[model samples]
Target: MLLKQMTAAALAAALSLFLSGSVTAAAEEHYDVYHYDCWSEAVPSQAGYTAERAVSGQDLGVGNFSEPTDIFRDSHDRFYIVDSGNDRIVVTDAELETVEKVFDTFTMPDGSETALNSPQGVYVAPETELLYIADYDNSRVLISDYDGNVQREITKPDSELFSQELTFLPQKVLADKAGNVYIVLGNITTGAAMFSSDGVFQGYYGANTVQTTPEVIVNHFRKLLSTDEMRSRQARTVPSGITNFDLDDEGFIYTCSQSTSQTQDTVKKLNAAGANLFSSLGVTWGDIRSYYDTNTNTNYQPMICDIEISDDKSINCLDLTTGRVFQYDKEGSLLFIFGSKSDQLGGFTEVTALESCGESIYVVDKRKNTVTVFAETDFGSLVHKATELYNAGYYEEALAPWYQVLQYDGNYVRAYEGIASGLLVKGDYEGSMRYAKLADSNSRYNKAFEGYRQEWLSAHFTQVAIVVILVAAVLTGLHFYRKKHIAKTETAERSEQP
Candidate 1:
């Protein structure tokens, strides 16, 4: 009874926090915070993206959706909504207004029919027009052509690479250009389960590292002192499980691991060899610290639930706790952050997935059973143009767009850095230094200072040399005259004494 009472009290406290945060957010309705650097925060003068509209079940002509899980937009711009609760997939046109087709049954090759069991994820291969579904209850990956004919089914591997004792439930899945399939299993802490095109289980790919704490280190020492039998009973640390993943146009798989306790490598770009190119740049993937909400007096750690990679290499990570989608450029610089947790149109109850179309972003709300589309604002366009040029090393050419970004949001730190880089390239060191200071880029400021100092020295070298020569000659003449005067005085005194 005491334990139950304590649990109830804890739940109530958590509910209070959520209610307070939602109330404050609804009252203000501002999604303006962007992380500039590890220690700095900036608010845009204008919202980068705004929720233009929401598409619910009523719009899909499907009465009402219960716990819709995933949303995907294929190359042909067709929208695929995985209606998990209904045990079916809803297909819509590019405009998302008309329902094109509904996938409820799969036609098997052996003159039989099978149905999906609470599919959580759906992926349509852009080239081959293949559909991959993670049938949760069925514990298999269902692959079919656009016509709903089951081409192949991926069950648990029969090889020793897979553990027979463990369940093979897949939550999310994606396919690469080479027909390689990757599935994110919820209970697998190793990584996403990888398989070849022939349905052969290869191995786990891109596993997160174990977060080392003081307790972990102590346990390691304790194991060294214990017997083998005792060591077997000790707890073994493991990597966090990957939640969801999406494939970019270039075939790199971008994944998100929803672990609030582990901060490192929450989002990653894994190459064909399963190496994380994101961490190779030595930068953090998301916000450096947990966001502190003053209204709720709570520190909301970022739990990245989903990732969407754009054609421009922009990575969008959806945070479940704050309902904010943190978007980063190709090189890991934060582009913009927008969203909130509320019952309003632009807000989200639960952010389950994110999908990127050309100029808009679609976020699926599991609780609301709707997908909210966010259209890019003029500010967002300017920011993207500037960031694209900046990341491409076209600093001078990016000046116009970067300045245009300032016109929209003067607080944008990247714009200042972009302008500074342009000025530095144009040999305007003083201007570069000024902008770099505003951007808080110490390396840029130092380089600009060095250039300014060198220019100053070069411009005044001749004048400085002439002054030095004149001072030396004057000193020598004064010394000789003083010596002659002393000698003459000595001669006169000697004559008088004689």
Candidate 2:
């Protein structure tokens, strides 16, 4: 009996250990959290954000979301989910815990009732408190109030600038601070359709420039040599249209386009004048490396489908092909990368849009009909605190937090860069240079090296000056000695000859 009891206890302990190990392994396998180092190599990293929970329509007391396409959080802290399949908009509270209202029908100004048909996008103007819905199948954008009263309807522009044969299938809509409306249309490569506040067509805005590739260069030469008929028979290459966009507090619009072949202009920060501000940075917006799929036996490149600018100015870009979220600082430096394509809790299927609220990120999955909420981890908070200070020019103040970040993540390249910046500002040039080298920041290292060189020269200036003076005096003495000796020898030779 004693032996039997001991065996049972051992069995129970083994089972417990096995179960715990399985749980830990499962959690780790959910996502591969990593960041690209200065060498463009993938380095393992601590998760900046984790999947806290997933909220569905049923969780919010509304029915299940049917193929939701977009999510927008207004200034009032309410979420407007565009349920495209249901042809309705579901409004929820900040936490997505309670349903506020469901907008299906709206009363027109002339007292006519109309309903949405396959709406794809929705945005709320904070200042005007108006709702902008991109009614896709209806081929129009509707501006309505919270009470479902239509204020205006913007349809396709009848102008030479816009192709008359193409349908105006609005996919996403946003309004600038000046009340100028921009709509992303289906199958239109020109750009987003822009309209004035009063509903007048203002032409397209923020068009992407075509990438110059070797093939394109060859094609250009071929077109030049070919006849007009032959050139017309060839297919015309055009820039990919904008997939989605978000406006920042400063009125800058961030747009993302889904393209696997084109790298340039995949993501753009456009100014009011329609110039890409991020063009000069030359930063890669999504995953730096391609991923191989065993099922398809093919490599998949990053397809950036959506982009969101957090309140703190962190740019969050969503990759459709891999279902990863790449978060970058305001200067386009990548901070963290997480998420994947799976059916697990943290995984996503057909991710369409994302919105950030405070420290949480809400990602909408169309195929799953659910929204996954990711909360910032402690490490993420530390990084953000350090980044905020660093970006604001408080390098010295950010040093401590950056150090703490290194304690958590020794491989964090950004933390090294931050520490180098702080040390540079504090006149620790040598120390700054060391950290800059670790961060792989050549620019920062150059600056630190220059500072160090100047400091060294300044400190040993007197010694160097004395040595230079001594060398000059010795050369002068040698010159006079040689001249005098040569003259004396010549005089002796002449006297001897006489």
Candidate 3:
């Protein structure tokens, strides 16, 4: 009895560590791919930063591996990677010492072998201990326990849906505390498919407002389906279909279904109750993400192939199509972006995945069949640290950090801004002006913000300062005058009355 209880406690502790996201991607070093069995003669350099190879072979004990689609760390510090090519979810011990197969029993749909079909994204939600997946090709969202047991499938209905094809070719899947899962697509939303944690389909929200024509992607919302219109159709076609999507965490569902009078990219942030609290551009149509290099201070335009939100809330965008990584802030502001055009060690040429584990960052180069790790110390030597220094009001100290990253990447953007801004703050107007002009000269269009920052400061600092002073003065005058008047009025009224 004592032995059995001890074993159970140990198992529970391990599981907890595997589910925590903070420690999930922990690693001291990284792997650089030298070979892969999937694609012949593939080189890690071809994948750029997306190609951070994982541990080779089944050496870590997870048993023979297959084409790993996505890698995630659980709270127990165990690594769970979906080996889609092998039709299995692989796991690694807390120490990453032994790789083992945790879930050998995944539910195969009515007539399938094994379980998953072209599974894309794999995420283990600690709040619910549920593993959510974008079961691509199946047109469904498959749910499972952390051990890879398929518990349920979430799919949209057909008969009453707007699109002739109610296909859910889910590309990415994410889950929040409310048991709501977010699914991105290889195509557009038929309606943002909603489901409870138990796999009960709540209903669909957000129409497929996106229409891909032979011409440019339609930015017009009126041409697409709207929520109100869906209501009218739902009552006729199907009683449960919806048109408005309110993502609790993302804030609002910027459905591009409104009339054309105002339709850029419908950006809306919604609350848990589905109330639209904020609305702005969510994602753009036909928009490809680009990365501006802080080193060369040049911008590289690439098709956004993959994107992930880091633990720090920074959006890690990858243009594996062009071999680049674009980092954007939560506010949609572009920060320093970096990637290699070279096929060399320490530098990437292609990317399969870009993951940020709390202590370090990892990039998987599928072509090379290896993972390259970047420690925080390694990151501290990069332009990002300098940007941090600049952001923390330590402008002068940021110069060295930014300069080091420039040695490796010449096109990084924030580095230029750091140098330029730091100079401005230090009262080096000439240096600041030089950097601003140089920044503008590089892209031939002032794509860098250093010039803009300097110009804006030079343009409005005095006006803003004067406004603050005037407002302060007026408030002070009003306070004093009101007090004096009240006192005098009381004296006059008393004397007259008496």
Candidate 4:
């Protein structure tokens, strides 16, 4: 009984907290989470690509990479690569050298030792340092630690609850700040999967409506094709070999719908409430080229084969064919483009993954089996960008750059406050309140927000009328109860006198 009482009390306290809207790690209503793409930069050059000691490139001697497909970083800043062709994962220091066997042997869920056929995605939870692998061949997401300790296979959502469709050959697996892993089943036709931090299957999203290259195109290309033509045709379905699946610290998932010759490709974003946000902003590599092509321009031919987000919330897409990396905003605004077709250890060739850790950027090139590091001092400029947008009255636009500022340096309290101001300028009171709390952290905006919120409530609802009616009813109930009790007591006394 005592334990039950304590549990109830605790639950009540939680309910009160929710009602008061004090804490927000969890929310009473739907949480609004948005995702921004970071900038993409080229891997440093090697062949005649000498750095000023400030720059570092990948160095693989003899036993290096066969087909380095993916790269991931653990909490300890250790790098892991899916050396697909070699059927192993390579571990190295911050510099992509000194290859060590992080996981010597890995297998399918059925204990079949057939090797990880094209392991594509690897994710490491910073908290637990547990690594999750999307084993494409085994059709399972293998869970383990950074030290190669095998955990368990993530199962499918129970078939009884939802009718199973197709078996997913997982591709890219990404983790948000909360440690939930989202996987892209290789066959876009099979859709994608989601799992909890502990490897428990959550649910699946999307459908097989993915656009793939038509059978006719593949058949036609099979008949008349040189080596180059064959490669290009094969990539028609997945133009960029890079994983489009990525995350912001917030719980939004950014996955490209399908890469093709279509006028536009959908970038399916699932919000915090599992709402599918449909947009076609950054998925149009072909369209971007057509703009140049239609104008009889040759300079705009896109050779991008990879994409990654920088710390600044802009996309960096590497043109493998051109050896260039382009950064674009959410609305497809080209911020900048760097690099040209260069085949060198430091320059990008067969480049794979790009990740941002504060002011530094990491680009892993599988051909070199190496990771290159670039330190950018211009992150402060990212703050200036947000400030410029805010000043220009583009409050919504400022929100993203402000977020980037905080991501690059959490100590930038001014950026947090700017986010609050931007939200206010956007006329999103609730959103303004959310960031304002974080900006102040001492409930400094409590009075202002409460006053605004109450004013909003009065205008938005029949709250005042409801309160008046409720108060009147409560008073009436108390008066009737007291009168009834006295009458009963008087009746009892009269009966005794008789």
Candidate 5:
């Protein structure tokens, strides 16, 4: 009886240990983290950002979020979540631990009471401390204060520039420092509707240009040759409209377009003139290669649904197609990619919006009715420190951090590039070239080679000069000796002939 009892105890202990180990392994493999190399190949990397926790409205004691479509973080570190299904906006503290306010009803300027009708988007202007809500079903944008007092109600423009046949359905809204409000409509493909602070429709803002492909070029020529009636019968093609946008502190607007076939202008960084500053970079916004699902036998392209620019100018793009977050630097170099479409804790079922605060990223899943918080790991922090220093023209100061990044992720190509740049700035051209080669940065490698050549010449300048001088003196002596010997031989021959 004693032996049987002892065996039972041993089996229980072993079973518990096995279960714990399995859980730890599963947690670590919840999601994959990688970055693209210069060749546009996905390179496995350490997790730069890991899912810390998923926060629901229930967790904050504000009831569960019902189909939250958008999330915005104001300058005051407050978060505003647009609960579309609930027809309200839930405001929370920076940590998302406590509920601050919930906006569902408001008082109109004329002392009339009103309520939000399926508000899809929300933004709080730092300058005016006012809330901008995109009232989807209501066909208007409501500007109100924290107390839910409606200051202005902007509806569809009655001007001829806007088509009267179209319905006024606003999806997203944002205001610039100049108080110019830009709104993304559901049907208008021209661009985001722009309005002045005084509630006057100015015009369209940043508009995407249609991609000129071979098929488009052919269709254009065919239409020109066809008669008016034939041209009218032909199908027309228009540019994909901007789906969402965000504004940075510098007043620059970043827009994202959700399209599977269009890759030209999936993401745009627009200036005040509404010109795309990122066009010249020729960089792909999301995954470089199409993702193939073995289970479904289908290939999926990145459909960027939302974009968030961090304080350090890192662009975090949320891809709805793959439910992955692609984070890039200011120069459009990919830093990290994480998340997936799964029922797992780290994975997102339907990612709708993303926002960055400090070193953490918050992504909202509409179907899941929760916001997953991703906190930067030590590897991510090191990479960010190096990137910040390198971008700020402090290459020498970034060297140590970049090296430390390599210790964590040896396959991190950005770390190699950063190290190469730092080495070049520190006058270690040879080392720079080596690292540049590893990073596949031909331009950096060429520059380093040139610097190395110049340095080598400068170091051996005396030896090179002395060798040139000695060679010249020896040649001159040989010339003189040959001329004298020829003359003496000619004289001896003449004397012998006489």
Candidate 6:
């Protein structure tokens, strides 16, 4: 019995050691290097964006944040954190280390005061130094200055166009270069509510388009055949509401709709006339496939919560589902995807907003009540430089940076495309075709093939013409020889018969 007990103890100890070794190996293999392929499938690649550090209220000496909703970086590089639950806006310096200013209440010109109530969005005009706040619970917008002096208070419109039965609960606000205010109302499917510089109610702008399917066509036909009473009972077709939007330096508005059902026009770049400038461009906004989580055994579809436009025309979109920030170029090519849904420093819970300040990106997590800062990696820098030149129509000049990107991440489809485009512009059609094929870019490959065919035909034109002429001459000589031989044979046969 004693000998058997000793052997069993030894076996148990060996099994324990093996289990610990397996756990250590799993930990070592885990890495945060997620990327999207040509088909928008999330795959592992070199790290593009990493969470450098996280800044909470503790880091900034603000005690603790409670439900921080939005983050914005203005032209002066100032950081604004909308502390909604605290009913105040926290301002930090360019480094985000020291507190610059805090606004809790607004003093009106009439010697009255108004305090913020669960403010959700904040925007500061660069030229005029004006601040716009979307006071959510109050159902109004407050136009103020840096010192919290109220310039005007814009409430719900009393217009014939607006439905009186509905409520105006503004969620996000922004100002254009001309001082026009655009406010996004909750549950408003028509578009963003636009206002004039003087606080007059303007019409809506940049409404989302309704996606049409076969069912929608059938419904429309049925509606046409139904009576007015039946038509009233039928379900009305409406567009998905716009979730968030950002303004570029060029006065263009970039908008995103977070509806999973409405896949078309999920992201759009609108011109002044509310025309989608990127409609003709073949690009999808977010991940093309549903993200599957092994731990939860569930599939998640990304809902874009906010959008931030960088000075170099990079589109940074915040995903609420997986806490990932998907960065795209001006032409809608995915540059890098970073962040995750974890309790770790780089991960997030309830990501609400995003702001881009120069080389860094700040994301606000409402549930965690913290702001996570992400700095660009070396791979990210190379990709951004290549994208800048490529978007500017300098394909040949972008070749070096794109090649450097490939050195870091050979599987980067965009880099392959960039190199292909550069080769095409340099008149190296065959070389361009090879890169285009590698990138799986059919349109680019077709262009390269057409150029190659044209060049080959031009080069061998003389040889082809000589061959055609010689062939034609030989055929004519053969025809005449056969005719002459037949005539002689016929004459000889006739003479012999006589």
Query: lDDT of candidate 2 vs native?
Result: 0.92
| Runs off by more than 4 Å, candidate 6 | 1-43, 221-234, 292-299, 446-462, 477-498
User: Each candidate's root-mean-square deviation in Å?
Assistant: 11.6, 4.9, 19.6, 22.3, 5.6, 7.4
TM agreement with the true structure for every prediction = 0.86, 0.89, 0.53, 0.51, 0.89, 0.86
Stronger candidate by TM-score (1 vs 2) = 2
Off by over 4 Å in 5: 1-29, 294-297, 466-498
lDDT of 5 by residue, 234-329 (tens): 988788899999998899999999986688879999998999999999888888988899999988989999999998999999999999999998
How many clashes in candidate 1? 0
Higher-ranked by lDDT: 2 or 6: 2
Better of 3 and 6 by TM-score: 6
lDDT (10s digit) by residue, model 3, range 315-383: 555545444455554455454334544555435555555566554455555554444554443433354
Against the hidden true structure, what lDDT does model 4 obtain? 0.57
State the lDDT of candidate 4 residue by residue for 1-498, as single tens digits.
999999999999999988767533222112111122222222221111111121222354435567677777665667777777666677767665565554646544565543456677787876677677877777777777654546667645564533478566677787677767777765444345667777767766543243345664675576466576666655343332223566645556655433333233334455775554545344444224322344755544444444555445655565444444545544444443343334543366666666655445566666655555644434535754875586566877888888877765554554666777776766666777877776664453564476578768879678778888999999999999999999999999999997
Task: Give lDDT tens digits, candidate 1, residues 255-332.
Answer: 888986677788888887878888867655556566799999988888899999887889899999889888889888
Model 6 clashing residue pairs (backbone): none
TM-score, cand. 4: 0.51
Q: For candidate 1, list the clashing residue pairs, or say none.
A: none
Prediction-by-prediction clash tally: 0, 0, 62, 16, 0, 0
lDDT of 2 by residue, 340-436 (tens): 9999987998999999999999999999999999888888899999999999999999999999999988999899999999999999999999999
Candidate 6 per-residue lDDT over residues 1-498, each given as its tens digit = 999999999999999999999854432212466677676666677766667778888789987888998888888999999999999899999888998988888998898888999999999999898989999999999999898889988899999878989888999999998989999999699899999999889989999888897778899999999999999999988898898999998999999888866767878899999999978886776666777889999878878889989989889988888888889888777887788888887788789999988888999999999988888777778888888899999999999999998887777888899999999999999999999998989999999999999999999999999999999999999999999999999999999997
Best of the candidates, TM-score: 2
Clashes of 6: 0
Q: Which stretches of candidate 4 lie over 4 Å from their true place?
A: 1-62, 97-101, 106-117, 155-168, 176-180, 196-203, 206-243, 263-269, 273-287, 291-307, 318-323, 329-333, 344-349, 366-498
